[model samples]
Target: MSLMLGYLEDYAKNRRGSHNYHTILVMGYAVAGKPEFALQLFGRMRYQGIDLDVFAYHVLLNALVEGNYYDGVEAVSNQIKSRGFESEVTHSILIKSFCRKKEFDRAETYLRRVMEGEVKIKGGGYIVGALVDGLCKDEQFDRAGKLVDEFGEFHVYDIWIRELVRARKLDGAMEFLHKTRNVVQYVPDLFRYNTLIIRLLRENRLEEVCDLIIEMRESNIPPDELTMNTVLCFFCKGGMVDIALRLYDSRGQIGLSLSSMAFNYLMNTLCGDGSVVDAYRILKNALEQGYFPGVPTFSVLAHALCKLEKLDMMNELFHVALENNVVLSDRIHEIYIQALCRTGRVEDGYYIHGELNRLNKVTTGCAYNSLINGFIKSNRADIAVRLLIEMQEKGHTPSRQLFRTVIQSVCETENPEKQFQRLLEMQLSLHEIDCGVFNIFIEGAGLAKKPDLANEVYQMMKRSGISPNVTSDILLLRSYLRGEKVSDGLHFFHNILERRAIGRKVFNTLIIGLCKANKPDIALSYFTNIRAKEKTVRPSLECYEELIYVLCNHKRYDKILDVIDDLIDVGRPLSSFIGNNLLLHSLKDRELYDTWVDSRPPTELTQPESSHIWRLREVVGLFSDRFRDDISIDDLEQVVRNCFPLDIYTYNMLLRKLCAKQVDDADKLFDTLCPKGYEPNQWTYETMVHGFYKHGRKDHAKLLLKEMVQRGFRPSEVTSALL
Candidate 1:
């Protein structure tokens, strides 16, 4: 590197157009893994007033990317644009850097800008191919396919085909290939055809494999050694060892040399299919032939032997693989550990885990998770927790499933607070202390009958900036009510009601709880308030009935009347249960009833000066005497005159009172009231039927009942029984 730098210095001092020569030298330095030297040369060139061309900028950009100086790359990019140097190579360098950083969206955006600027991308779609490969690696096959289609480039076709096979969309991929051939006159190469055949063999699509082979032969494309190995492995794994051996023997006849990978593939497949003895025989034969299987093959056999409870054999295979200098993948190691742990050999599993750690192979959370789950399954949660801490300390985030396992174990402990603290610790460690995680704690507290802890969790959830959902509100509301914290329950009730969060079931629960706690006054206030506010919660009828029953039992007469008034104003009929209770109380306590009646507002009278009020009062007064003797018709007439212009409601009440007594003038009073421009309603007919039935005039009562039914009026239960 120093010699090259010295040569560049000597040439720059002795040559014209030294700037161009220096840029070439910078590229050389960058290619040699000395990006800093390239950058230093660039700076020196600028200081010497050298004319930096597009090539210089391109080389400098590559240097910045190689050094992972993202900011420096951007600065060089801006310089290239400012100098009006259109370098497709520079654009591709930026795209590749962004893709390597997993910033695929930024890469796509920059690519689109370059395309829109009419700059022809160089190097046979290298930029597009990098993006496509990155997207495929990220499992974004759909985006990759769209990008390839937009560019009409087949450079990334192999990637799309491989991804489609991996995703199990082999048919779609085949159809795409057929369409590309027809529309663009494009032909797939041998490697792509091999990829399809291998995947088809793995999926056991023998008919498609046969057809593809026939098509390949017609196109003068023959299967390579890798293809035969893939087929051999597929047949062995599918429990067709006989066919696999035949294929292995026929490889020499087909002008193919035996490869170690082919031998490993056969042994691995045989072990995976539970033919460990057969796989061992194959391994021995391969060893005699100077071909040794790799770590993946040995790991597969070890896992199979461990599954069959043959740990002795598994250990021998592990030693052999180590002696062969074969390096096992983390997944293979994890599989071995999991098998041992499953067979009640967790100590052995832990030893293997330690060995892997020594080899720097235990880096992923998945490896830790397997051991953690194994420990948890064996009821050694403390060990699992220790392992979890170790995992996090190694910069691996614990999965939610791992945390849940530990939490469930913690909850089984004697101390509830310890369980809560452990869960909180897990959340903090994972940086996942969101509402969902806290909701679990809140629900757990409620189930454990720990309302205080539930409230704590709710507060914590809010402080964590996760707004509570309807379930959260409902859980907390129920917790407060269950704890007999009536004030807090009601406060939450009001808050949720305002937010329109409480559903009918939750509201009913709260109301029922309040009534059961002997706090019907508070419940009644809530009921009334909900009714008065438009778009607020409307309590169920059962809730209203509970409130009315409790209010009457407590003798809150004013509230009862108010409730009745509100029900009437809303055109909602009072439930028969509540109506009957009010009627019973009114009759049993006449003075209190009279006071309630007198407390009605003057507006309800409709006309304070009207005689209907006086007449109704006088009729109620004679209710006590009319049962003892028959009243004369002239006295009934005088009473009717006092109530002149009486409404139908008052008339119905007067008729109902008279029917309870033996007063003969009740019929005359009804006759006089109807002739005085009063339309006889259903209640009027029902009242006369009761009068006739009480007077033993069943025929007249039947006529009135028939007339009431004809007027589309269904009789009340009381009126039907009377008829």
Candidate 2:
């Protein structure tokens, strides 16, 4: 407008425009809301003897009033009247001008004067409608209502209803809306219902909003996009998600384009309802409509989709976030990455993890864990080890199990030494070469059966001027035993003893490791040394159980009895593994029971109730016929349970003994196995299979073997031969 005005002024200075062109210019500025310029041009028009017509005058007058320029309005009104071109628009403009200037009395006088014919102005509806609207705008709502009542015109009532709703008088808006619908037998317009409904929705008057929407339907007033969008929001927030979802689906048919708030509400509510897939669909549609959800809403829906393992949707969501430049929270990104890893999309997860890197984001500890484990499962532990070290460098603490997994996975590689050495170099370089870090390398080498490598790491630890802690000594000793370098292990153990007094933990690790290495003689020698102490430091119960198991494996029944005497002397209750071992060995051969009877102290057998020897004596009688009348297998299981909670191995022993006499007892024990929450292992299955075959139920035995194989437990050699 300014450009045009400037051009026109230059044009006029050169040559004048026609009267119609000049008038058009004045109206143009007024219509364009450049009232100052419009009035300036109007004054120019009058000076040039070019007067605006009635329509131009009224347009200028209304524009002045709208711009709150009462001075221009008065000047324009007087000019229209002086030209005798006054109409109802002229007085209405004056009345509106007075109201805008807060001169209510003058506005009301003009209305009365015009109505009474004192002023012969026409356009009664136009005149009264403007004043009532102005009154409502001025918050003279009661007076506006009275004016609406006095006129009793639908147009006036409609204007007042809009005013009421705009002022947030929702109840009054609805009341007048009902009046229009009831007494007047007319639906005001879509705007009326929509505005009222929106206000009601804002105030959470859901029932009323629903009623008004119904009213629109019953009145045959077709809903616009706003109405449908509002309804979708209402249904979603009110826990009527099914209806909301239906409305969302029919968005195209109903001409419903979702508003930002409606989209936010629908997606968030759907996720809360566990309708994650549907929420994902809505999110896709929302993106199409160019509505980028806020962070919280996107996160809620993204997490839900991830939880439900809707990977395809989560992938799309990730791309959407990427494409839109939506910076999701690290936690949300971590959720997607972890979910991908869980669903075996580790490569895809790693790809996204790179995205986090490019974004300069620190991957969460939990995500690193999942990704590392995922890579391990994929046999990419080389990659997993790198991530583990990276995780530590980023100041996140990897779980011991996680580190163990990476190390174990590395040990399982084809060239474990090369890979593990590579990993160890990286690990040691990540921090100072403390004993703890070197211990991990030793432990890893031990696990790889590379006792030589483990010894090298131990030496390196000493070279770093960090003397080995007991933990370090234990790891190196176990490494030797794990590699079956029993001589080396013995040397290391004696060196440890020479340097300092070791605790039960070190003794237990060596004893257990040696037992695992099948060197029971060395383990027993150490056990002897432990028992020979004046204040003999009792080995752990687990250590005792391990020694007795290896002793049973060696069939050194006399040695087993000697260990049992040491166990009794140490005041440690016999573990179920030890007791069950004795029973199983007795059932296999008379060696254990004979050893017990031969080594029995003549007076210890008569020991008081405080003595565990009595229990040991009864356990021996389980094999001999001497206790058959006094003790049943059921009685023995109970006695064992009372002594120490019976393990599954104990149950296997009981099942074996029962198979010799009553197959019914074995069947009973097998049935109770599941109810006792005992997951049957290979030994348990073998015991049952043996029981079945001996009882002449070959089909049952084969069936048990099949189940064992199905459970990933291979049948033992003896059981296979029987089958």
Candidate 3:
């Protein structure tokens, strides 16, 4: 390579080179993969009074054509026109060049000029095949099919069919095949069968593959070694190794001689199935039989070694590939990197990625992803960030999934706010900030109590023509709620709904948020608005639970009654805690209870067997002084046992209110209960201590205070003030 560069440098110094030298030197530069240097040489030749002939122009023109430089072709054309070398070879080269370039219009212009006898082309299958291949690549399948049809009897018509298949125009190619049924020379060949079977395998049409193979047999077209290799690949991928082996044995009966290509496919299939030992045996035997597996043949072993966590074996095969002049695909490199990352050898993975980049084989998106994700997993955010910037500089655009992984990683970091800010700044500088990336930042902002940053991103998204999704809207609502801007969240919900931007989830979020914020009236209004707008909206259990909690908190007794009616009709399970709390609050004592009973119909509150009603009765019985001595103690005990189950908070509430009764029996009851693991809460301790002081039992209050502190129950200022 150094010798080739030295020659190029020496030849480029000759400013007055002849047309022959110019063509030779340009071709040499292109062969050395220095197209830029070739263009520079051409420019220098023009500057030094060197006149380019048709042959010199053809060399530069073909370079532009092959390198996909359409504008460069036009520049060369203008340079040619400035001179006077407008001959038939120039025009034919232009026509064939346009065809190769997929400029079908320009190609058609020159082809018409040639057909009208204004110009001449060295007309043959080579030029036709070039046009057919380019048209198929350009997805002008109809035009390519027409050319194949027009030249159906030509010996190279089968070649055009192969081109169509290569371009993945299976349907069009098959249609052309059916139309040219009379062309006996285009009969199904080994290449055709291999192409079809490979495609079917890729498409996972294993069942259809069997049918095609059977059809080949019936048509008297024996499956060649390549055909058998494709079938073996299909079976291996489908995990049917038994059937693939059976077919392999039957190859001899069909008089088929297996080539090294066939053995390599067999090994690839076996290696991918975790049968590395079997693959090694096959490869060794093939080598002994004077068959060498080609370059693509090593990827299977490399990837398989990676899958089996045998990195040493994988490296051995990769080096073998390098020695054998086999170019490894990016996927093989990706597998090795992922294996390194998975084993916690993240630095090794990065090193391998760098080596691959230096080799000009850095097309590994998965390898880059593994490096980033591994850094995140190892808590090395700074390194992951540097890698992302490095990837962008290398012209590799990170995929959406990569962004997702990065966002998720940063969001989970301890100081999410600072992490999000850094990410936002980085993305903004690189012009990589989109709605999805911004939404993650917004989520972190809400968590960090930074609504201002979230809103700024929201405005940026709008300015950049990015439409926000439901998650974005929800994040904004959370931001407002976190900032104590409840009205803003409410207004945003209302505006989104008014604009008919309402989805079921958004409606449910608004309802639950309002209810949670203690705005029961607002929640009810939104529910009513949704029902009016979308009458088909079926209420979910979540909505009902929210409404029940909201109604109980706001003491909307009448609304509670109406809600209970709807709930009963709906026939879902009643929330016992909300029901007990609501009933207890409504029936403060006998006077409040009498008013509730008088207002409600007798049937509305008649679930006598329910725990809610029994708890209500139990709470009423606590005010024993209100009831006469005629109320049975047995009846009260039964109510407490059967009506309400005891939980930590339930025991606390009962014990606190019992102390508030200022009864000597209440103290006796507390003494009995304290031994049963029913330790009182802060509220319970405060209630008992305060009750003792209010009733002039200072000695008992002091005892309660000491117990409270010992039990880690810190009473509030109000309770301390009484002490």
Candidate 4:
């Protein structure tokens, strides 16, 4: 590999050959997973006055990105820019850099600059793809859509842009895509089409995605594994178990091989959504094809069996994993045990536990925790306690999680205070109890409304040199609040705020308790005092909304304006639910808009309204499967009148759609264009001819051919093929 690399490096610098040696050198390093070496070679080659072509740049840029050497990327970019050669590859590299660093603005700036500059290396599908991906990542749909249009000269952008649209960046992706109405490289081979379709499926845009198999038939593109897997995933995502079974229906015709990874993804998705029977059917299909199932597939199957309380199915999946030489993970074994235990099979869970113990694989705390949780769930607290003791005897110290689970379980069965006291005593006999364990006890005591017990737990925590967390303090405060011990709750809240510095959530909980106890005035006093002191600290949107809600219920409408002002200043619009209620409440006060919209801070006006919902709809519309449906002649005319009046691409798209429906209408459409003061170019004739051939209308094709011959317009390969 190094020798091949050395030859490429020498060739790139020699500059004597027609072959692109730098490209070869860079490719060698990229393929070898040593992209840094490729960059190093590129740096040295630059000093030799040999221009790094687009191909060389891509390989090196990809290598740099793949190896995560981001800082080096800018240097190469500057070098390209300095030479006044911002090729598509250079732009793509810059876009990729921003994508990796998540600095989308810089990537976009470079893209626009690439568009503005002369063609150093003519832009292609990949350049547009990188920009679309970056914009999608940054959630900047509007600009991405426009950029797609600018780069939509090639049909490749259609496939990737569709992918972006499917990824839910449809509005930005479509603005560019909708400009070109021709069937983009519609059959962009199988891989690109599959990628776009599968992405659409993931985004739940099934109705919009067309029958890809049928699309391939129309376009004469052969179907591959990628195409089949895409459709299979769609069926799996849609819960169309019968459609998934159609793999068997087409296996003989399409020569399908149900790839293990694809099968695993389908099984996992189905099982996760509790479609175990569907998963089982898929596995059975795989079995019929003589393919061994993988570990993840079996693991999901086991999980589903556990959910359904099917111990026999769980065991069968477990054995299948082993039969297929699939290594069972601790999760799988734990699920198997839990499933067995739930169905009155504790002996089976224990037996598996014993087998793990014998193999000395029960060292981790996770497997033990799973078993203990299972026991607690089954009301077998005594068995859970025994298991903890067994774990300790094996020199594996019990985790705080384990202790908390067992203690909480014991509390349910008997006097929790007595059990906690016993555990505290037991802790003294061994090592110290964890702060987390004490916190858990405090929470349990608070939940049981035992303030004294919770206080005792807190005191124990301090004495053990295990300081209570904010959670522990909150629990203790809640205990006091529940008992209407306002002074105690307030004192604890202050200490917690001072010591642990608990945030809004804890503060909100305390304030809520005060309001519930009919101490709204006191709660308001505390709220005012907190707001005055903590300049940096502010209520969350939920806290502010809830406070407003409480005030509204008390007919304290005067106080709501202040909270609304705060919300407006913080740039939080009311949620749809709250907005409806707020509108009703605002009707009672003329000063509502003054507080909500014309707030104290002029800076708040600068904040953009949340574009999430609007952008989401726009994106959905862009990748919408609606476009694939057959458009009526009337609809085409309407689209032309409304959408095409200003936009050339829309006119072209409408023209293509209309011409597709009636091929001989090309002359009539051209005449209509002249009367409308618009000139028709080769694009118009090309689209009509392409459409004629696409639908196999040979008479219309011959007519166009005869016209072209008379007009002295020679046919290109595409035009010849159309004829």
Once superposed on the true structure, which residue ranges of model 2 sit more than 4 Å away at CA? 1-216, 222-242, 259-261, 272-275, 379-382, 399-426, 586-590, 623-626, 629-637, 647-723
Candidates in order, TM-scores: namely 0.33, 0.65, 0.37, 0.37
- Candidate 1 wrongly placed segments (more than 4 Å): 1-262, 284-291, 299-325, 338-348, 393-402, 419-423, 426-453, 459-723
At residue 153, give the lDDT of candidate 1: 66
Candidate with better TM-score, 2 vs 4? 2
Candidate 1 vs 4: which has more lDDT: 1
**Backbone clashes, candidate 1:** 0
Candidate closest to the true structure, highest lDDT: 2
Q: Model-by-model lDDT, in order?
A: 0.70, 0.82, 0.68, 0.64
Model 4, 385-442: lDDT tens digits are 7777667766677766567567667667766667668765665555556776677667
lDDT of 3: 0.68
The count of backbone overlaps in candidate 4 is: 6
Pick the TM-score winner: 2
Q: So what's the TM-score on candidate 3?
A: 0.37
Count the clashes in each prediction.
Answer: 0, 0, 0, 6
Query: For candidate 2, lDDT tens digit of each residue in 1-723?
Result: 567667656755665555488777777778777788889989987897888888988989989998988788888888888999888878778888888888888888888888888665446877888899888888888988888878766677778878888999988888777876788786778988788888887787878886887787788887898788887887887898998888788777666788888888888888989999888877777777777788888788888888888888888887888788887888988999899998899999999889988988899999999999999999997789889988898899887677767887888888887887788888878777788788777787788787888888788788878999988899889889999998889899889989998788788998899899898898898888776873546678899899999999898877887887778777888887788777777778876777777876688667875556677667667755456543455676876665566888888877777777777777788888999898778888888888888889999999989989999997878888888
Which residue pairs collide, candidate 2? Answer: none
As a whole number from 0 to 100, the lDDT of residue 611 in candidate 2 is: 57
